[model samples]
Target: MFDVLQVGQQHGTSTDRSRIGAEPVLLSLSPTIVGSRGGAMVTMRSGQAAQAALREEHWQEMERFGDFLTDEDLAALPQTIRDGLIGVRRPGGMRYPAFQIVNWGDGTKEVPPAWLQLVELLAPAGWNDEFLILWTSAPNAYLEGASPAQTIQSFPTEVTAELRYAAERAIPTRPGGPGSWQ
Candidate 1:
């Protein structure tokens, strides 16, 4: 949690309240933008901190999850936004599209060369996003739930994730046992 604003102002300030000699009173503040103010402090208890909260179970699950995918399977994941796999992973459902990066030339069954269109795919955890073709050679996938589109054709580049895949990356605990390469 973060205190939007904490100012010591005068409690009894009439209509003509000025920055003159007035008693100190706690001021309620709501920040329009986070981390913007005078000595703003964000406090969180243990096991609640963003970094520490990632439980060990989630990490182990992801490690096991990673093992299922072969090098070819990992490499087979959609590299382009227009091209994504038919089935990936879902919590309870059968399958879902997992955002990934792939090459355009390396056409697969799901995405053919003719169907090279800018598309959207959910990121890890859950996200409303669009897949973008980074440089023609190496494309990177990103999720955009707040904005309108996926590609950052606008002036300011937007690279932010509204959701997360939980322990897929942060835990560092291997999932899926081992890959074929290993």
Candidate 2:
């Protein structure tokens, strides 16, 4: 068993330009760790694995999302809920990936159900938000050219299959899975 903890600073940093702080997100992985890419593999203890993973990637905050969303728009959403959006506490502020908030082009915005299921599945495992965002944003062979988030909005069946694959890969109990520290 592993314990994961994440606490954000009360304020944001000058670089990130928002109210997010350095989140020492604690992730507990199994004896064997999976690299950020789904198929790559590594062997390390949980703590070392977590630190190494954090060092491997950088996170961008909500402010960087450009026209997709504004501070006012994010404020309108419920901050405490994981729901469909994934928020990471960064030195600059609470940032979300641009893909999480889809612009319908008709002025209606909605979170895809598949996206929400993936977030809910991985969050409790202490999966870093960076990893989560990367997985969703990265290209997958199963979804053709679209990332998971995009597929979630455009193809319902593809999204469900993708989410199932992600969950299987992220948890260690399932063999050949993408193993997390926990």
Candidate 3:
């Protein structure tokens, strides 16, 4: 588990009168964004700091008749959004990123806004969903060790900034010219 020292003031002032101080308060954070001020910290009970889990390249079936999503739901998305999905093939068959599908119950589903934006940004940069899935799920230093997916769901603004930073970092610089390759 990793400990992210969050200064409360860095986020924003809270109206709650019970808080310790008006200034920043150091918080122990976790893997997922907790409350607005505190986050769920990954446990480090083993004495050694826990690292973010490495993502494997394998894909899950987009049409899996499972609780996550179904074939009919995938068919219901707008064509443009549907086309934007990254497809991969393993020995089994074509599959999509499991993270892209959000189950809202009653068989309803939605793709996250942050996720869609990241896909749009990365597509022009020659980055694919395979890269996106891994990158977004992996722990990020900019997010204070939180994964992009986790940050996006709770702290929307922070995630957008992180995305912009990523785009800037991914832009290729020419040897002597100002223009980027893409």
Candidate 4:
């Protein structure tokens, strides 16, 4: 059995521009292993083992994104270009999602026109990098089950509308009246 622990602020680093003054929240996995040898045998994973497993899992997830640029890789690019893309900070380093950029294969990367608008729409929300990555990758109801990352390029207008609606909902409002708390 594995239990997840939400660890707050493992490192004081964030790649997401919108998440100023905020650090990435890390999830640690703690697992208890059970075996049967004509009976029941139980073993507990040490802290270091759990951490190593978590790091491995993070790398596996990163690989699923296909090709990504690290923080060091992005440092070679212009600041404006770096600011236009979204990056998530993981155990080892920051990873910029490749879907937002067009790799020219000559060590050059360009942000698509629609990505600029998408980043702008997401900036004011102050969303952390983890949430930003998950939101973009996950199937959205507003998109009729299409992921934002998948449709943002082809359906920029629709993606923009969905982002606007999501941003509006993210704002906390006093439903009762001024000075009222929910």
Candidate 5:
């Protein structure tokens, strides 16, 4: 029951530019146990445990997959989507390691291998937390050639329209793709 949000101005003139606002991305995610490589546990203080469990289940599915997609599929993404996802990282402001997860679909075609693989790679295990949900929607800030813009380097700023726009744009929506999850 959480929505991701981001804050930062679009920098540069397109080519040699970048977004240098916050880091670590304070995820407004659902509460769940984060398993680390060493099996340490940390929980979110302001989120739902059940929802976090569900999200973990989704991520686990990705971990179970090995090369579920092909190079062709990754390359096929709209250039914007590809660029956006290819080099994404957690926002720097975060106190601990975290990622803004996205809800795409339950299939290979609908979800990319890199993204699928990333969810697993980034979500190694150890840290955990309770997530917070908002009544408003997120943004659509899809990257240049990566996965749809679902996750955002977020902070506690009271989810605003501007934040939603950034998220939506970050997430590259395929012309006739699935809508946002409640």
Candidate 6:
């Protein structure tokens, strides 16, 4: 069984703490478990600390994608190419992830055709940009613990197959007619 961390009341004055309410909440992520006579002791960050850590981790992960293209930067590209790129909403505005772009020594950049194909496969799901980004970057069980973004370059076929399966799963199907009770 997975170890669980029980977080007590937060110590900070930030309003984010109130969101956790008066009760201590349990979390399973990154828990530190220790054996004791009673049972076990689990240590974890407070709500505020966990939130801060999550924000920092998100910022660092976004940094790994290289430079994010702003509206002005994207406007420099042709409309067709711009439309094919994946852009996520941020605090300021829409920022395009440049992971698909291959930069040449001459300063020109090109988006891989395979990346566009992957985007096309996921388009029918109508997932938001943030979800798309997370889905690609996060470790997927369907991909055997490898993130789609990590293996897409070397294992395009496998990634494509997984994406197709995910798309099919996302489609809602009715088991029977709406009027039917059983």
What is the number of backbone collisions in each predicted candidate, taken in the order shown?
A: 10, 11, 6, 0, 62, 0
TM-score of structure candidate 2: 0.48
Which of the two, 1 or 3, has more lDDT?
Answer: 3
lDDT of 6 by residue, 1-182 (tens): 33444466434343557677765544344444333334765444455457656755774577666547888888888776676678777667887766556555688666656567777767766777776776676676767787666656554333367755654454344455332234
The digit string of per-residue lDDT tens for model 2 on 12-72 reads 3234545367654334333434454357554566778777655444333223445134445
Q: Give the Cα lDDT of each candidate.
A: 0.31, 0.57, 0.52, 0.63, 0.34, 0.61
Scored by Cα lDDT, where does model 6 land?
0.61
Candidate 4 structure, TM-score to reference: 0.49
On TM-score, the leading prediction is 4
Work out the TM-score per prediction: 0.20, 0.48, 0.45, 0.49, 0.21, 0.48
lDDT by residue (15-116, candidate 3, tens digit) is 567766776544433323223214644434222222222233222322343213233445777665466455554445555555565445577655666667
Best by lDDT: 4
Off by over 4 Å in 6: 1-60, 64-67, 103-108, 155-159, 162-182
What is the TM-score (0 to 1) of candidate 5? 0.21
Model 1: per-residue Cα lDDT over 1-182, one tens digit each: 34344465433424446745676544333322233235865444332454333433433343456522334454644465323434333343323222223233455333322213222222222322211211111223323232212222221122223212211232233444221122
In the range 1-182, model 5's lDDT, one tens digit per residue, is 33323445332332323545534333433333444434655554334456665755543443355312333544655554443332211222212111222334453222233334433333322223211111111122333222222333232213334444334433334555333232
lDDT of 3: 0.52
Superposition error at 164 for model 4 (Å) = 4.0
Model 5 alpha-carbon drift over 4 Å, by segment: 1-38, 43-48, 58-72, 84-182
The alpha-carbon RMSD values of the candidates against the true structure, listed in the order shown, are: 17.9, 16.4, 16.8, 16.2, 20.7, 12.6
Query: What is the alpha-carbon lDDT for the whole of candidate 2?
Result: 0.57
What local lDDT does model 2 show for residue 71? 49
Per-residue alpha-carbon lDDT of candidate 4 for residues 1-182, written as tens digits (9 for 90 to 100): 55443455333334678887787744335434444435866455666457656655655775676557788888888887787777776657778877776655587656766667666666665677766666676566767787677776555434467655654454444575322355
